[model samples]
Target: MPNRWLCLLLLPACISAVTLDCKHIRIDKKDFDLSALGGPKTIHQQRWLPPSISNTTFTIDLCNPLKKLKGIDSKEQCPSGTRVCGIEERYNPIDGVKEVTEVRPIAGEFSTSHGRAMDPEVTRLKESSNADQEGLRIELRGGKFPETRQGDLQKAIIELHCDAELTGNEGFEDDEAAVDVAGYGSMSKRAKDDKDDEDEDEPELPDLDKGKSLQFVSYKNEKDDVGVLRLTWKTKYACENAEKAPAKEPGNKSSGWGFFTWFFVVSFLLIAAYIIFGSWLNYTRYGARGMDLIPHSDMIRDLPYIAKEWVGGVADRMKSGGSRGGYSAV
Candidate 1:
């Protein structure tokens, strides 16, 4: 009985652990759809340190786990459910070789939060003087660095900028262009073939050019902190007015008559009905004929004379100019 109660209590938390829907992100009563930017993006940075050159590659996917690309090794990448991963390699000039130094899971979890501090935090970026800078910021902080003694948590901060011209896939010539997966070339032929087979099962990435793709701005690692990585991305989906209710089709007419139109229509119908009934009643009862059969005949006939006299009165008033006949007091 106690186990049953515990299961019931845990059901709500499990149900709420589903992945976030990037298509409809509601912020400040406005919705921004980023589904167009859904796919893994890889970035590389190289720095010279003493005799060896250090190269770092970072991969992230907002909508799902990173796919198995051609050059990236499964072992060097993040764990199965990671959303962001970073790997660093050092090249020695003397040995003419490169060595994989670190594989860091920057953000993701094996399962639900379960009271752990593993949930991703998303918030709106503060607006600046430049309109293009408006966007969202996401902070992911559950991954751990494998080299840290204290099991230090890894953090990744992603800033999305609003760029209508970008689709987020710009500058990447091919899927494997930017990826330098460590140890991939050293694998045996059989292992390489197996990896290739796995990659073939995955869906092909879209062929996108710089004209309509997401633009990668920059990546910065805080010098004071080794566990933090900040990256900036520009896409049209980050704009405030990215998605709105689709406009009505041009060929479709309005659903119904407007207020004034209905009012005038109803009014004309009522007046016509009244006149027809009055004329019919007069002809039946008194055998009326011609103009006499019309309702309010006298008033209708006098309308033209009444209008003429009103116009003459206005003309006389204008000519008199409200002047006194006698001389004005001096």
Candidate 2:
């Protein structure tokens, strides 16, 4: 009897365990910014721009179209099981199609509007920044309203924040480092095998895997009564600096030494060879010894003496022509 009663009590829990169909909700990478000081950080269908502890506003844009709102076309409704959370439409005023800022939920079903309604989730949940606390702590809280009408849907968005601490490595890469939020699991997709372009001169980045994983944090369907989803991530600026390549030490010699050393050495050898060859030639011609062979042997040992005697004779014979600058050619 006790076992049967236990099974009967557990029947409702088993039946209500259907996973919330949140495959449609997607995070917009562009709307998310870690640099804001104290503004609406998360982006949702409804606009909420003020009254936050920090000026930073991380936005999550529901790229998925809405389904069941009061004034919207039925063709625009979200999937059947999902209820209406927020309506994002442009008001066609006389000026033109201006963006509607007012938060609109399913009419006559829920009174709450805007994103601040998520404060309760933040209050209920507690999260710490990374161990280093490298940046501002952005908290997230979310849940769903009871299904007053059939197919009532709950809308949720994720927020990422970096604290006042700024790591200079920010903006180094297009993709931000994956964040590991406590109790929230990892905020990045699992890695897959894809070729990386090593030719690009990109700086070292965190070893986060990039894959086509669904960008959701968590979701819970409350016994077909309400559905809740929550997601949080740290700002890219909060990531730790990647290890930089070590500085190269200067070489012992200058860059040109290899060519210059070989050139000088070869030049010296050639010059020594030329002198030795000339000396040998002079020795073979005149049979002179020692330094006499350095200059042409004929010029040093024979020509100077012969020229002196010849010049003395010529001077005596051609004094008159010499004085007139017309010496005889003989």
Candidate 3:
């Protein structure tokens, strides 16, 4: 049988194409009956980090006000001489304490949107809460980020998000609504072991300026949304200074052939062509493609009758469009 495969081989080049130049970001990072548009997807955020070259934002696991757990921290553990640190009359009061140990923040900045962070209402009631009768501990999870290198890096911001909508079917104005965090400054065991090997008299802190505490907040979106915040490492060069000129390399001319020379040559040719023959080129491209030279010996070798159809059909097709008829033999 004549092979059916020969007919299938030419099918792909005959199909029409669909263009995909459109783009979008879902509103509220939310899920709705967007099945009509592509998704009714759930987009819950679990933590926040800072952006590098641009604004950074992310989310933290929010504790629910109505839930509680017990036995995580006993009331007896609030030591008599423990130290404490907090804003003026702003944090929950630690009671029955003979002493309060002050907390030294590794880095901190107050956020208007992230108020009541160590929310006493949540911590006190969740008996299993990382919260103590003294204070609360918290959990962090669910990260999505592009991979990053672990190098001479001291502080890292691995993810970012914004316009957090955390109220869960509730509007933004509830007075009790707030978000909180609980985590310690962390490093690898290798890092800790390196520290253990060092001198006891002097402590090393990563230079704070390079890894500044970060906060980015915008209140402009909507009532149901928490104002967005981003995180970032401190930039060595301030934004205003990035536009200043690079310093001179100090020479009258470059040393050898470079891309600059190649670009100059190509650009010169294009301008010269536009002035000389661009209109002619635009009009004659099809005529040019149809005009190909076959050597006399090769032309003689083709089946003569099929060759006549090839040449005559292409010429007639060109002439129908009021263009040059392609070449043919007498």
Candidate 4:
């Protein structure tokens, strides 16, 4: 399970190396004048301008119609380049006068209404400023929403930077040291493989045979719920000082290395526990059962007597046992 998750995680880090598309992060904070008695830092929402779209304008006309009403012929849509086209009526053949009636055009056929993005899942990350420190930079990917023309502009559009923690448990293919931005762990669907079981009786458990596993994580102070900027990110200012840089320690190496260091610390504790626990079992079960006959080989071997009878002994008392807490022992 860990292996699959590791692969999934490593895939991104690997790609990041080939192409570092991380956007520039700016933590906008106001520095109080020395005269002002120690003011704390504050985060202000900033509206980011999208990159320009070459050979295109933000202003596009609404769809124009094919036919106009007799009385409404003088009226036109709000913006130019709007088009709305539909089929007009055709007259039916009649015997007497053979008169033809005009068909009217409807609006739905070809029309353009200002459309907004749907399902914009905005994610945020902590980024650094000119100085490398903890900050947030939102990352957006293509989803159900339409691909935004890089030049869409809006008034008072504020970015809500998220603070969810993410982690990567993956390894590198070429044994190169991976850059782990954060220690905190992080963040999709499937189709039916079995044709027979369209209607399942029991709930299908997630397939773990391939080593894929789900990561549990959480966040706080979510400003909004609906959508965030598409193809854009919101990075927060560094909580710590942007200047007065700290140095990275040389002792720590790779993520896997950290695991062994910590894992061994736990393993050694468990081993000591087993040794002490096994000694206690041996002394309790057959401390003096047959000392002379018992060989040292059987007493303290690598594999302790695993049988429940030896370890989980029977508790019994020599007769007259009903007398309030009689001499009963293990």
What TM-score do all the candidates reach, one by one? 0.54, 0.22, 0.16, 0.17
Give the per-residue lDDT digits (tens) of candidate 4, residues 7-126.
Answer: 988976654432212222233442111111011111111111111001100111011112333443232211221111111111111111111121111111111233321111112223
Arrange candidates by TM-score, highest first: which order?
1, 2, 4, 3
How many angstroms is residue 258 displaced in model 3 relative to the true structure, after the best TM-score fit? Answer: 7.2
Over 4 Å off, model 2: 1-59, 62-214, 222-226, 232-234, 237-330
Positional deviation of 12 in candidate 2, in angstroms? Answer: 43
Q: Which 10 successive residues of model 3 have the least lDDT summed?
A: 34-43
Per-residue CA lDDT of model 3 for 1-330, tens digit only, reads 246675566544331111110021122232111011111111111211110011111221121111211452333121111111111111111121122122111111111221211211111112443222221112211111111232111111112111122111112112111112111123222334444554422223222122122222221222333222222211211111122212222232545679989899999998777644644563466333221222232445667977899999999787787644645557
- lDDT, candidate 3, equals 0.24
Indicate the worst ten consecutive residues by lDDT in candidate 1: 200-209
Residue 266 lDDT in model 4? Answer: 94
TM-score of 4: 0.17
TM-score, candidate 2, is 0.22
> What lDDT score belongs to each candidate, Candidate 1 first?
0.65, 0.35, 0.24, 0.25
Ranking by lDDT: 1, 2, 4, 3
> What are the clash counts of all predictions, listed in order?
6, 26, 24, 23
lDDT of 1 by residue, 1-330 (tens): 999999999976863554555766777787877765666777765654534456676777886766655676777666776788877777554345677787878776555532223466667775443445688887776677663456656777778887777655666545442434343233333333444353433222222223424333444445544467777787777778775422332333567889999999999999999999999999999899999999999999999999999999999888888688747978
lDDT of 2 by residue, 1-330 (tens): 999999989966653332221221112221222222121122222221211001111123222222334665554333232222332333221222233232323211121332222221121112343443432222222323333345444544343344234322232233321122221122112111111433423222223223211123544454454444444443343332322211221222334558778999999999889889988888999897887778664566777789999999998877665465656567
Choose the strongest candidate by TM-score. Answer: 1
Models, CA RMSD each: 19.8, 31.6, 25.7, 27.0
